[model samples]
Target: MTTLGHKSSMDHHLTGMSDNTVERPGERAPLVLNMDKFSQVTATVCRVSEAERAPIAWYICFTLSLGLLSVLGVCIGYLFLTGVGVWGLNNPVMWAYDITNFVFWVGIGHAGTLISAILFLFRQKWRTGINRFAEAMTIFAVICAGTFPGIHVGRVWFAYWLFPIPNQMEMWPQFRSPLLWDVFAVSTYFTVSLLFWYTGMVPDLATLRDRAKGKLQQLGYGLFALGWRGSNRHWHRYERAYLILAALSTPLVLSVHSVVSFDFATSQLPGWHTTIFPPYFVAGAIFSGFAMVVTLAVPARELFGLKDLITLRHLDNMNKVILATGCMVGYAYSMEFFIAWYSGAMYEKFAFMNRAFGQYWWAYLIMVSCNVITPQLFWFKKLRTSIPIMFVLSIIVNVGMWFERFVIIVSSLANDFLPTSWDSFTPTWVDIGTMVGAFGLFFTLFLLFCRYLPMIAMAEVKAVMPQADPHGAGAGKHGHAHH
Candidate 1:
């Protein structure tokens, strides 16, 4: 009787039930809204995957994605037949769209590990709503990012030599280059992220397996489920593995981008040679990453009728992150100029000046306006919460970030010490097609994932709801207690 009374009172407080009750200023709004029952959460998420046919929008988007993917394939085939000369590789501008796109996509993958591992460690319950697909985005983005370096090497057949392996020829990868560091860092990051993503999906996969009506569905989901029975022992192991992976992934979120920064920082080039690149790259990465999340989230929530699950609050919070990181990136931009001037080095000062007013000044201007100026609009609550505004702003943020890379790489390389050899770089049609094709690849995988997989981490979402409390009102009613 006492326990029941206690549970009822706690439930009342959690639910904000009393007419006179006022929400405290610091109290977080509910992460999941509407459809109070645990079963409702399960049914809503499952319906997207279980539907006999996806909505017409899915077909239209998928068709477009497939077309882009075909474009990517043709471009790659042409490039293999032709050469790296097919790109706009000029005298001084060897690294143009290829490196820029590589870094952009790698940065795009950062938000997943951040949302999943870092937020989970901090006990941020809101992460449960979006982390699943963010992780999927990470994997796909990495796949796109990885494509560049492989093909950029020119000798695609000899790409395997990038790895350290024994052979009759005794060829070994250069140990000193930061480029090699990227090989290890990105590959390790991908492996761990894949494991983390799959581990989180096990219980949810088991759910799909049990809910399967067809034999093939059962077998496919069951194969991946790995005998998840929801037993306490199974959960115990599951949680331990998850926590460990989260811990592992947190460092990776910091390390992967830092290593990527090393690609430029280790160089002797004036603008590229700076200590600030690590943190700057990481911040810009998270900034652009969250923007991509917003870009995808806005469409996803609306298309799938997930407005209640992925509420305005979620979008609002992500915009705030975008705003914060945008400030960091802006600060980094100013600091680069400050460092260049403060160092009393003519070459460094010239490098910074050239970026602002040099041949590629237009690119630099776009980078600053899009990356630094655009996100400031989020400071206003009304603007940040507006769906259409945030969507457009999110896309703009990515465009700015891409230009950020372009400005950093192309500007520095184009204006290297000897002005006599400097030449303007103009990308060929293959370059534009290849970059667009990478987008196609990313969306193709993502669309398929949404169609077949549990787009939400169903078990994780249930764990955060009020009814997950063992002593709550809904406890024991429908076996909704989180395992």
Candidate 2:
């Protein structure tokens, strides 16, 4: 119904649908399948949301997630009705499952912002296919993460005390406290991430609005689309806002994790006190985040029939990132040991030794093998490119990262300088159930998102299409010269 005379030509050129070939020289392997038409792209991505019924796997996963979420709820409710004593928290091991799960989910959220903000700033076009889903993952991961620290306070009702609220009592949070720092950092991150996600989604929502068949669908999408009308002015404004959000988000990716690390770094604990924690935590966060993305995306692309858009090339690229970050994490692990030994501090040296050969030696070994050793499989093209291998490895990476937190939190506190105060910690059923429930919560939100929202950003994907680039070399071949 809209004018396509000029746009159709551009689309044809960009999509490589016309005689004027848009293929770059030495076009090695196709990133996307050769079908690059704008209409096809739209049809492929939007079809999921607009489908008559979701795939059976979606229902199966959704139902399972709900069941697990219920378990989490029960666990939390029990904790509230009783007390923090329901957990296995002892004197030396006060932080166990709660802190471990908090750090794990927080780490999981990093890849989304890194891909959405950092990669976007760097002009990584491959990110287009996966950014939307990864951002959603980030948001859900943060929600799951935030739930932990809130409940970890024991008296959930007084959790608001962590916030700086001006009231009759006039109590304010201590700015110097690392815990308070986390509150501000995580809250700011969640806000900006949500805004960035929603802003990017607007134009695509507009596409849905225009294409919606039912009146309710049209109304729902129209309300959120903000009256987008494909005008050049609207496009210009949208791009500017998107750029600003991306720029803002880039530093946040670094800062949020850095602050999270400060919770440990500022401490006097042997294993926790270190200068390398910021970059080390950041690297580990990105490593785990990418693994989670791959884990989710591999199944999703297959089950959702999005193979062309979320291609093997995309998976391969993500695996490369996982490998790179995994190496960084491995290096950090090695450096930590070396630094401890060289520093000539008895407590520091013992802390490193205790971690590797202490009562929790199995946990440390799992962390090292999973985080450091497993990802080296990616050096082979066949392994990185193989979806099955990458998916399994991704899950392993998450497991390793979780244990990494456990090793740091429990191992350090359990065998500190004073041997008499040292003790081993075991998680209660409540602790286990609550941690498991966090996964349920994360997947539940993700499943609902996949069911309702466009898993892929259509407009952004289209923008990268050849026809969308008016001044490309291919445009000149199409009797259209760039001014």
Best by lDDT: 1
lDDT of each residue in 269-349, candidate 1, tens digit only: 989999999999999999999999999999988888777677787788899999999999999999999999999999999
Candidate 1 clashing pairs, residues 3+ apart or interchain: none
What candidate 2 gets wrong by more than 4 Å, as runs, is 1-30, 472-478
lDDT tens digits, residue span 1-483, model 2: 122335543343345321221335644233345455678888888898899999998999999999999999999999999999999999989899999999999999999999999999999988999999999999999999999999999889989999878868877779999989999999999998899889889888888898999999999999999898889988788789889999999999899999999999999999999999999999999999999999999999988888877877788889999999999999999999999999999999999999999999999999999999999999898898887899999999999999999999999999988999999999889999999999999999999989778899888877776555555423535445536
lDDT of 1 at 218: 98
Provide TM-scores for the models: 0.95, 0.94
Give candidate 2's error at residue 433 in angstroms: 0.4
Position 366, candidate 1: lDDT: 97
lDDT of all the models against the reference? Answer: 0.90, 0.89
